[model samples]
Each structure stands twice: as C-alpha cells, then as structure tokens.
Target: MKGIVLENKILNDKYGIICIKSDEFAQNAAPGQFLMIRPQPYDYIYDPLLRRPLGICDINEKKGTFSLLYMIVGKGTKLLSKIKKKTELSFSEPLGTGFNLTTDKKVAIIGGGVGIAPMTFLSKILHENNEVDVFYGGAEEKDILLTHIFEEYSNNLIIATEDGSIGHKGFITEVFENSLKFNNYDKIFACGPKPMLKAVYDIIDIEKIEFEVSLEERMACGIGACLGCIISTIGTDPNSNSQKRCCVEGPVFNGKEIIWETVCKE
Candidate 1:
C-alpha cells in the first residue's frame, strides 16, 4: 500500500516519529504488526534496496493515520528521518501476527528503547478493557519518549534508565522482577532487547501467568518467501527445533514455546 506522510516529528537527534495517512492501515493495523517501509530520496533509485521493518507505534483510525516511531540507527532510518511531509511512500500491508488482545484482566507490559514503539499501540488497545502496568527502560531520561502516551493508557507506569536519570536507576527488568514478587498479573507481554526479553522470560513463572514476547529480527522481505528472518523454536517432535519466519509467523509468540537457548545464541 502507498501512504502520504502527514507529519514527521523529530524528538531528538537520534529519534523521530513519522505519521502517514493510510485509511487501510489505520483501519486494519493491529498491535505488534509491522510495516516494511522503503526509504529513498527518489522513487527511481533503489540505493538502499531493502525496505526496513518498523512496528506500528500509534494509529488513529478515525483520522486515517498511523505513525512509525524509529531511531536513526542506520542508513535507511537516516533517510527515513529526512523524508518530508506529503511525500508518498510505499508500505507493505500490515505484516506478521499481532499480540492477542485480552480483556478484563491485569497485565504487565515491558518495553525498552525502540521496542517501546509497538507496546504503545498495544497498551492503548488493552487499556480500554484491561488494567495495564507498563515498564519502560532506556539509556537515559531522554530516551524515554513515550511516557506521556503510555501514561494515558496504563494503570501504572514505571521508567528506568541506566544512568539513574529516571524513575529507576537500573534496568527495567529488575523493576519488573521486583513487581512480580508483590503483584500477581494475569499476563505479561514484552518487546525489547534480547537480553531484556531473556531476563523477563527467566523471571516469570510460566505455569502461573501467561506470557507473550515480541521478537525483533532483521528481515530482507516482509513475507514468508524470504528465509532471512527465521528463528528457532521447540519442534513438535521435541528432538529438534522448528524454524519460524519472524515476518510471517510472528513478531509475537508465546514466551513459553520459545527456545531460550537458541534465541540467546542468535
């Protein structure tokens, strides 16, 4: 699908949020799904060649708009940040599986850095019917950009920064772990760095609470045809691992079904 940029709000030298007007996307986009966006100075050029995958950060269905919150970590994102308003760009239809929404339950949501993008959308939808507790961590206070948005949807919000400039001085996982000992949540959902996800997986008791994690992988194509983004999971036979396409089968999966050893080794 093609969309026109409505606004490009740069939060800092390292991060920006691009809002696009796409009726189809706004109406159909689900939490945790992503878009394969091609960023180029000109349509005739294919310099970057591959479209970068970015999760849907926020969507305004009534306004027919969706936003992509990204950090300028590479050449593609650098180019994406320079794109001007009203510029038309091509996007893959909302790709990959989304988080299963639950209602009338207590849940914990964790996000770190750019991973916080999709969690905002998830929190927004989940909050209307469920009680949400959000834990967000970053390198510093400035990296915590989505608190205001999360605040509106979350029942409780916790922020952590490595530099001791935010709510908690250490990792957000540490805070989440501490919360687990005191509060009993019906479910837990997380999307962040591998280390953080691993930490969350280890901290939770899978038998007691349901948990889901959104995995991040580099993808060449946002479709199952490309084998570039396969991750190993426990196979049905239990003797070997199953390879699942992150673009097609997931960006979200049951945390309990994941092979932690394989995930950490990657």
Candidate 2:
C-alpha cells in the first residue's frame, strides 16, 4: 500500500511518531499488527533495500489515518526521522497475526520502551470487553510514550522507569509483581526488550496466567521467504513446529510455544 506522510514529529528527541494519511492501509489495519515500511520516497533508493517492519501504533478509522511510533536506534529509523510531511512512501502492510481480543476476564499488558507501541493498540481494543491494565516502563520520565491514551482505554494505568523519574522506580517486572498482589489476572500480553519479556513470562507462568508474547526479530523479507526472523518453539524435532516465523505466523504466540532455554534470560 502507498501512503503520504502527514506528520512526523519527534518525541523526547529519542524517537518520533509518523502519522500518515493512507486510505488503503489504515482501513485494513488491526490491533497489534505491523507494516513493512520504507520511509524513503517511492523514487529514492533506500540504502537498505529491506523495508523496516514497524507495529501499527494508532489506527484512526474515522480520519482514515494510521501512525507508526519508532525509536531512532539504527540507520533505518534515523532515515525515518528525516522524512517530512507529504512524503509519499510505499508499504507492505497489515501483516502477521494480531492479538486475540476476546474474553471478559482480567487482562494486563506490560511493555517497555518502544514495545509500548503495539500494546496501546491492543489495549484500546481489549478494554472494550475485558478489565485491562497497562504497565509501561521506560528509561526516564520522558520515555513513557502515551499515558493519556492508555488512561482513556484501560481500567488501570501503571508506569515504571529505570531512573525513578516516573510512577514506579524500577523495572516493569517489579511493577508487575506488585500488581499481582492486588489483582488476579486471567491473561497477560507482553512485548518489550528480551529481558523484560522473559521476566514477565516467568512470573506469569508461575501464576498460571494464560499469556501471549509478541517477539521482535530482524526481518530481511517481511513475507517470511528469507527465514530471517525465526524464533524457537517447544517442539524442537525436525519437521516439527520448532521454528516459528515472526513475520508471517506471528509477532504473537502462546506463552508455552516459546522455548525459554533458547532465549537469553539476562
């Protein structure tokens, strides 16, 4: 799908949010789904031939707009930040399986840093039927992305910062553990840095809370043809469901499907 950048505004100088007016992509976008975006104009040759895959942060159906919130971690994102309004870019969109939004049970979404992108989209939809809680953690105060958005959609909004500059003065895992004392959650959805995701998985597993995690992997081909973004699954036997594709089959997977030993906990 093709889109024209309507706004590209920097937030906290560390990252930026690019809102685009796209009739095709936005109309078909779903919560927690992503798009493979090439920030360069259609005529330009982007240094990296592969488009960067970004999660859909906001979907405004009424306005026919969608936005991507990205952190400037590498060259791909750096280029994305330079893109200006009215820039026409191409995308392969609405890819991968989004979160399953059902159930009247209690649900919690714990995310860190840029991982908060998809959680906001999920929170907005899940809160409509379930009791939802959103726990967002960042490096500092300014890193706490969008609190007002979460507040409007979730039943409880909690935040954590490494620098003690925000709601809770520790990792989001700490906040999650404390939250368990007061709330009995039936399910959890987490997306974040590997360590935080692992920690959340461990705790929720012990509590026997049904949960799913969204994995982040580097993909050269967003269509899963390159097999570049493979994640380990429990069934390790050959021809088994041992290797999962982050681009096609997921981004979201059952908690038990992940092979914890294969992931670096620390």
Candidate 3:
C-alpha cells in the first residue's frame, strides 16, 4: 500500500516521528505490527534497496493518518529522516503478528529509547478496557522523548533516566522491580534493548506472570522468505531447539519461552 508522509521531524537528537496519511492502513493496523518503508522521493528510489521495518506508533482513523516513530540510525533511516511533508512513500504494512492484546487487562508496558514507539498503539487500545501503566527510561534527558503521548494513554506513566536528569534516577528496570513489590500487574509487555526485556522476564518468571516481548532484527524480506532475521527460541516449534525468524511467528513472543542468554548472545 502507499501512504504520504504528513509529518517527519526530530523528537530529539536521537529520534524522529513520521506521520503518514493512510486511512486503510491505519484502520486495519494492529498493535505491534510493522510497515516496511521504502522512500521513493525525487528519483532516489532503489538507492537503499531494502525497506526498513518500523513499528506502527499510532493511528488516527478519522484523520486518515498513522504515525511511525523511529531512531535516526544507519543510512536507510538517515534518508527517511529527510522526508518532507506530502512526499509519498511505498509501504508493506500490518505485517507480522502484533502484541497479544486479548488478555490480562491490568498490564505494564515497558519501553526504552526507540523501543517506546510500538507501545503507543498497544497502550491506546488496551487503555480503553484495561489499566495500563507505562515505564520508560533513557540515557539522558534528551533521550526521554515523547513522555506526553505515553502519559495521555497510560493510567500511570513513570519516567526514569540513568543520568538522574528526570524522574527516577536509575534504570527503568529498578522502577519496574520496585513497582512489582506492591502492585501486581496481570500481564507485562516489554520492548527495548534485549537486556531490559530480560530483566523484566527474570524478575517475574518465578511468579509465573504472563509476558510478551517484541523483538528487533535485520530482515531482507519482512516476511519469512529471506530468513535473515532468525533467532533461537526455547519453545517447542520448528525453531524450538533451533531458531525462529523475528520477522514472522514473532516480533512478539512468549517471554517465558525465550532462552534469554542463548538467544541474546552475540
């Protein structure tokens, strides 16, 4: 499908938000699904042949717009950063399975840096019927972008910075740990650096809390065909004792089923 870039600007020194006009895509998009974006502006097509995968940050059905939040990393994203208003781009959207929004109404969704992007839509839909708490962290003040959006959708939006420049002066993980001491979350979902997701899983694994985590990987083909984004899984599947493509079968997966150390090992 095709969409027009309505807004594209920096969130901070590290991140940018790109909003697009696409009614059909926005109406059908599910939380955690991504769009393979290929910028085709001013005869610059095919320079970066592979489209980058970005999570759908938000959707406004009435306005005919859907937004993608991205970090300005690498050559592909740098080109994406240059997109101006009204420029049309190619997209392969609503791809892969999104977060499991069907259960555990009282949910804790934790995100860090660019990882916070995907949590927006998930929080929005879940907020309508569930108690949603969002915890976010960054290296410094600038990295802690988009607090207001999360605040709008969450019952409680907790902020943390490692530099102590903002809310809690520690890892978002520390806040998560302390929160679990008293407040019992029915379910937990996390996206960010793998280490953060692993921490969330470790703390609650013993208690048997349900959790789903969205992953990141490099994909040649966003669908399963290319197999460029395979990662090991502990769960029983064809990839059980083997590996699963992060582009399919997951971008979201059972937290308890992932062998954190082995799968995350470099």
Candidate 4:
C-alpha cells in the first residue's frame, strides 16, 4: 500500500456521498480499475482492518492526482467520510484489468449505481477514437451522480431512475435496448449489478452484439495473493470446470465467455 494525503473533499450529500481528490497514484491508473485503500493512523477501536476497495473515479495526470467517489455504506466507509483534507491514506492502486477499447468503433456504455465510477474513465479513453453513448441507472435522482463528467465523452447520454425523479422511469437496460435499435454500435461495455448484466447478456445473446462486462466480487487481497475472489469459467476441458480469479484474471471479461447462468444463480 502507498501512503498519500487528500488534497480536497467534495461532499455530494449527507448520506456520506464524497468525492475525494488525492495525489496517490493517479498517473498509473487506468479506466475501469480501482484502488484498495486503508485509512492511515488506523483506528483499531473504530476501523479494525484496512480500507475497502474504491474505484478510480477520475485522474488528472498533469497534476498527478486521482479521485474516488464513494457512499459511506459501512463502518470503513463511515470513517473515510470523516476524514478531512490533508489526512493521509494508504492505497494499492491500478488494480484489475480495465475495459478493452476497439479502434474506430462506436460503443454503448452502460453503468448502474456506483459502477458509474470506472465508466467515466472508460469514456475518457474511448472519446479519443470511438464514439460513446452512455446509459446510466440509479434508484433515484440523488443516487445518480457524476453526470457532467460522462457528458464530456458521451455522444448521447441517457438516464433512468426507478422513482422517475429524473430521466426515464425505468431501468438503464431499457434505455440501452432502445439505443440499440436506432444506433449501429460495434460493441457494448457495462459495469453494474449482476442482475443488470445478466439482463444485458440475455439481450445480446440473441442479438449477437459484441459485449464486455466488469464484475464485482468481494475481495480479500487486491492482488492475486489470496484466492478469495475466484470465479468459475468455461474453458478448455469441458468435463472439468476451471476457475478464474477476478482479482487477477479479470474484473473485466468477454460477455459470452462468462458462465452467466451460474454467476447469476449465485
């Protein structure tokens, strides 16, 4: 883990929605990747273990800074929320394989909930050569954050919220499917809940549109040192099943290669 101090904190709400800017490991990070962080001066009374994994929200290479947007969901995150500017934090960064960008191709990007973090970086990368269309879904209006950043790279931006507080009163997949009908996209890139990804896979399975998905699993060690994040895959030797460690093999995988039935059922 690398120790770095926060430069700024931009709170999105009282629910512990925070965007932290730090000069930890910005230049080395890639889109759809993350950092495993542990708050410095560890509080054994409050936070026992190291910090949890946070996706790299955005990076400013020129300034050598990176950002992380997180909602305080648990004890660790709650402590993280209380941290002020200039407070030091430890980070294990540039972890996980990111999205694969195809040259000269138009792609549809889909994100749900906090999964939108990495998509912002992915959009920045894809904007260089490929046209990007983004579809984002959240529980409500407040849940949907970082719209302005995505708009910078997206040729078309669509939003969906369950409460109808914002854009369409439905799921992101609905918007994604609608976009598919009118656009000729070469591929689809997505990161979100497993159910949403399964739904997307079902649609593309029949339509035969090339797609890639980033999976989120509980990880013990950010690196492959621990086998805690193993996921099964259908590889050669069909009679014998194989496993791929999400920490190393992929947080990103080809949509078709994933054993969706087993993954979804689990």
Candidate 5:
C-alpha cells in the first residue's frame, strides 16, 4: 500500500460524510474504478486486512489530485472519518476495470445512493466525447449529493426520490421509463441497489438496449487474491457453469452477459 496524506476534507453530514483529496496517485485512477483505503492511525485496530474500497469520485489532473467521497458506515469508515487533514492514509488504488465508453453514442448513466459516486466520474469522461444523460435516485433530498457535478456533464439530468422531495415523486426507474419515450439512447450504464439494477435489466432486456452495470458486492482482497467476492455468470463454454469473482474479473460487466436470475436467486 502507498501512504499519502489527506490534503483536504469536507464534512457533509451527521453520518460522517466527507471528501478526501489525495496525492497525484489518484490521478492515475479511471472513472468507475476505486481505491482501498485504511486509516494510518488505526493500523493496530484494523490492519493486515483489506480496507474499505472507495470509488474515485473526482479527479483534478492539472492539480495532480483526486477525491473520494464516502459515508461512515462501519468502524473502519468511522475511524477514517475522524482523520484530520494532513494525516497520512495507506491505500492500494486505481483498482478494477472501468466502464466501457463507445464514442459517438448516446449514453444514459443511472445511479442510486452511494452508487452515484462512480457515475459522476463516468459522466465527466463520457461528456468529452458522447451525448450523456444522468438519472440519480435517493430516498429523500438529503440522500442526494453531488447533483451539481452531474448536471455540468449531462445533457439531461433526472432526479427521483421516494418522498417527492426532489425531481420526481417516484423511483428513478419511473424517470428512466418516461425519458425513454422522448430520447433514444444507444447504451445504458447503471449502479445502485440490487433491486434497482434488476429492474433496469428487465427494462433494457425488453427494449433491446445495450448496457453495462457496476455491481456492489462484499469484497476482501480487492485485487482478487481472495475468493471473497464471487458472482455467478453465464459462460459460453459448453462444459462449464458457475460463479466468477467480482473483484478480479469485474466490478463492471456487460449487462446482458450477467446471469440475472442466478444473481437474484442468491
């Protein structure tokens, strides 16, 4: 792991939300990829084990820095939240294959909850060469963060919250369905809750739209050394059938290539 000091921090909520700006190493990271971080001071309390994997939210190539936005969801994250600026952090980064972007295509990116992190990065990159649209979903207004970033890159920005406190009063899928009537996109990129992904998969399956999905699975050894993050796939080999490791093989996969029924079964 490489050790780098936290250059800046911004707290966004009571759940210990914040963005950490790290050194130039993060600039090497791609959109839809992540870094594994562990608080330096918490080594004794939590060491030798993989740290929490945080998606690369944004990057400043000119400044030689990148950002990671995360919520305090566990002991590791809580300890990370307490880290002061200038404190050194240990990390293994620029991990995982990123989204596949085909030039000259109309692409729609969808995200829910924390899954929105990577989508922000993807939107920025796609905006440089293709028509980009974004759909973000949250339980309420507070759950929605970084809409401004997405708006800057997307040609169309749609928001959905369960309480009707934001753009649409229903699920993001509703916005997706409604938008499809007016806009025909060539590809879809999605990441969010399992149910949301499944629903999207079903929709795209019927519509015959090509798509890619970034999946969230419990992982250990983010580099795939450990078999802790296995996900099933439909293989073409005539004699074989089974699961694959999400960490090593992908966090991103061709939406149609995924065995949705098997994945939902587990």
Candidate 6:
C-alpha cells in the first residue's frame, strides 16, 4: 500500500531515519520484520526501479506511523534520503518472519551499526515483561543513531564504538561476551553485519540459551518471488545444508541454524 512520508531526518552523511504514516504498517509491524519501499519521490521516476527493503525501526500504533532507519548505501537509498515530507511512497506489507517474543526471563539484545534499527521495537516489547539488556556498537560515534530511544526500553543500555567516541572502546561483542559471563540470560536476539553475528554465534552457549539473529541481505523482490535473497542453513543431515529465502522464510532465524562459514564467505 501507499504511505505518506511524515518525516525524513538525516542523521549524518551515512544514515537517516524516515517515518511514514501507515496505519496498516504500524499496527501490524513486528520487531525484525521489514518492508520494501520504492525510493523515487514519484512513481514515474523509476531509475532505481526495485523497492528497497528497510527494517521496521519503530512503531507508534496510536499515531498510525512507523519508522525506518537506513544507511546511504547506494543509488536507491540515496534517493530515499531525499524524499520529502508528505510525499507518498509505495511500500510492501511488513514482510519476513519476526523474532519470537518470550517473557519473564533475562534477555540480551545486541545490535551494530544500522542493524540497531530492528532491535529498538524488539527491545521495547521485550523490556515490558523481561529484564532487558541492550548492547549497541558502531564504527564511530555517528554510527550510533538512537540511544535515547533504546534507553527508554531497556533495563541497561551498553554501548561501544571502535574509535573510542562513545561508551566502550572496543567491539560491542567484547562487551556482550563480558556480560554473558556475569548474566545468565535466558534468551538473546541480535542483528548486525554478518561478521558481528558470527562473532555472537561463536560466544553464546546455544545449548543453554536460545539465540536468534536478524540477517541483512540484498533483495530483488521483497516477497518470495525472486531467489536473490537465499541463505544456507543446516539441514537434517549434518553433511548437507538447505537453502532458505531471507525475504520470506526469515530475516530472523536461530543462530545455530545458520551455516556461519557460508555467511562469512558471502
């Protein structure tokens, strides 16, 4: 359906936040789910014809609005940044599987860079009924987008920046690992670059903790039609693996189910 752009705030040279007024999207959006939006300001100017997949960053059900945090990665997203307020953009229904929400347990939420977008809503929902700890990391201070918002929804907000511009001086994973040693978290949810997810996968004790990771991929068709967003996952037989569409089967999956080597290689 078509959604009107309520606001498009550019965070920096690299990142921006766009809010859209879509009652259908806001009411239905779940953490980790994404929507595909065409970037052009007008439907006819379709130079970048394909719809860009953006994670559902925040939702205001009563206000009938949803936000997307995106990076200026290519022509599509660059155009997305220039979209004006009140402009109507074409958006797909909220797509992909969202994180499974569980309550009454200690939970760890990890995010890095723009990957932090989807975690906000998840943290908000989880914090209401669970002890939530959020670990956010970025390459620099500019990479940290919405800490104030995260703080409102988490019991503890831990931050790290590689250039020592923010909270911790090292990788966010390092802080996460340290926290894991002290906290017996019952569940964990993460979304970041693949290497960060792999690093997280390596540190967590999967047998003792349930962990899920939201993956990032380039998609041609946000629905399952195109086979462009396929990823490898473990099959019933250890020697083989099965393929899954990132746009449909998941953007969220158990960390254990992913074949890390394949993800790292891609």
Q: Relative to the unseen true structure, what is the C-alpha lDDT of residue 208 in candidate 3, on a scale of 0 to 100?
A: 63
Task: Pull out the clashing pairs in model 1.
Answer: none
> What's the alpha carbon RMSD for model 1?
0.9
lDDT of 4 by residue, 75-154 (tens): 77777777776665667767988777777888889999887877888888888899888999988897788788878888
lDDT of 3 by residue, 1-266 (tens): 88889889877767889999999998888899888888556446567888889998999989989999888888888888888999988888688889988544788999987888899888988888899999998777877877788888889999999998999998999999999987888889899998888888888854567899999888988999998887777755654476778888889988877779976784
lDDT for residue 226 in candidate 3, whole number 0-100 = 98
On lDDT, the stronger of 1 and 5 is: 1
lDDT of 1 at 72: 93
Give the per-residue lDDT of model 1 (tens digit) for 30-128: 999999999864667877999999999999999999999999999999999999999999988999999998999999999999999999999999999
Alpha-carbon RMSD to native, per candidate: 0.9, 2.0, 1.9, 2.3, 2.3, 0.9
Predictions in order: lDDT: 0.92, 0.86, 0.85, 0.77, 0.77, 0.93
Give residue 36's lDDT in candidate 6 (0 to 100): 94
User: For model 6, how does the per-residue alpha-carbon lDDT over 108-227 read when each residue is reduced to its tens digit?
Assistant: 999999999999989989988999999999999999989898889999999999998999999999999998778999999999999999999899888989999999898999899999
Given candidate 4, what's the lDDT at residue 265?
78
Off by over 4 Å in 2: 44-46, 236-241
lDDT (Cα) of model 5: 0.77
TM-score of every model? 0.98, 0.94, 0.94, 0.91, 0.90, 0.98
| Model 1 regions lying over 4 Å from their true place | none
Error of 2 at 186 (Å): 1.1
